[model samples]
Target: MKYLRKLVIGATCLVSMAASAQWQWTDKDGRKVYSDRAPPSDILDKNILKRPAGRVNPLVTNEASLNAASPVAAASSPHGSASAPKLSGVDKELAEKKKKAEEAEVAKRKAEEERVAKSKIENCARAKQAKTNFDSGIRIARTNEKGEREIMDDATRSAEAKRIQFIIDSDCK
Candidate 1:
């Protein structure tokens, strides 16, 4: 019996405490204001915004109330239903396009690298053959601009061999 009495007294106190919260007058800026205590006696009743049940803060307008007040405004809100349905399709298409573009770029880069590697291998092979001919004391001949075959001299052969060795060092790496 004593426990039930204490529980009832506690429940009454909680109910009264919650009921004490109320919406007061709007400020000078026209924004609604809420308070746990009643407005001063000097304030007019007309300025009072609302006396919501429970402990709802009247100054903070919830989504349900805003949607109830204006259907058009609710439809245009970011969290509204209008834009939600179309987002999935648009996002998927955009993601697919972005992925394809990235894949194409990677393929182009790989093809270019392969071409460069083939060119380097060809150059290294030619340079190595020229170096071997130079080491064998073979008389290297070149076609001059006038289309005449000119046999390379010892000095010219030495310079050509040095140049070929340099090419081999650079390209074989």
Candidate 2:
């Protein structure tokens, strides 16, 4: 029972440590930001009030500790650059997910643009064909709201030609 309790407690501690926020900083808009990832490079060191456990901030150098620990040793430490946050595996995963989301957004935008372009091209082609038919002196007929087919008069044909020309002007270019 004692051994199980100790194991459970240890596991909980490890989980909590992994979940705890490692970065805290005031953003440009003055909001305090708490994140498990490093603050953006634009954030000044003074704005970063907290960092993951043992990163040595160059801006707030501890003179005594710096003297005791050789510069070579600090640079060679497993934690990475003393002045910068060590990127954890979680940060890498998050970065990869963000990049994929951005790519997906770009692809979605490209697809929408292509669809709009295709629609415009189809509209332009149909309008040009209708304009050609109108110019060829063919009498066109349209159904009225009363469900009766009506032969177009000269005024109606000219008006229709104007509308088709407007569509061609807007979509062909």
Candidate 3:
């Protein structure tokens, strides 16, 4: 009796769901038609619309079958045995060799970077020495020469004028 009642209720739900399914079609000479079933062959390529039959509600389906037979869990869980998936011997050896090669390459890169950094420091020191020598020449002509070298007043004045002119020409041009 209970099984019969359940069957009747299930049939009623399916009928109601199917009733909501809709489709539309247009004929060749501009006529419109609608039906739940697929369109006839003549207007198959014309303006045809099909609303798919409803599916069982996902929440209801999942709740009803949460613990039911699941092939996914069975296949993944070791075929009812405790043995684990094992890599082949060749694959294991290849993985170890690849790891060692990667480590060696990393070490080589680190050594190259250290060499470049040391070379840059030496080059910067050389550049600083050249700049210091050039600056000393300019200082001697502008300030140090005037302070230390004894000369006639006219000659000293002319030398200072020449230094000022040289600075202006070099800086402003």
Model 1 lDDT, full chain set: 0.78
Q: For model 3, how does the per-residue alpha-carbon lDDT over 36-145 read when each residue is reduced to its tens digit?
A: 87777776543564344642223323332533446444344433324557545578778899999999999999999999777766655655554454545443333355
**TM-score of each model, paired residue for residue:** 0.54, 0.51, 0.30
Top lDDT: which candidate number?
A: 2
Off by over 4 Å in 3: 1-90, 138-173
- Which lDDT value does model 2 have at 23? 78
Alpha-carbon RMSD, each predicted model: 17.8, 11.5, 19.0
Q: Compare candidates 2 and 3 on lDDT and give the better one.
A: 2
In model 2, what lDDT does residue 76 have? 51
| TM value for model 2 | 0.51
lDDT of candidate 1 over 54-152, digit per residue (tens): 433333456677578678757855465666555554677788999999999999999999999999999999999989999998778999999999999
List the global CA lDDT of all models: 0.78, 0.83, 0.58
Error of 3 at 3 (Å): 77
Count of backbone collisions in candidate 1: 0
Which model, 1 or 2, shows the larger TM-score?
Answer: 1
Sorted by lDDT (best first), the order is 2, 1, 3
How far residue 110's Cα lies from its native spot in candidate 1, in Å, is 1.0
Give the higher-TM-score candidate: 2 or 3: 2
Residue 90 CA error for candidate 1 (Å)?
A: 8.4
The 10 consecutive residues of candidate 1 with the worst lDDT sum are 52-61
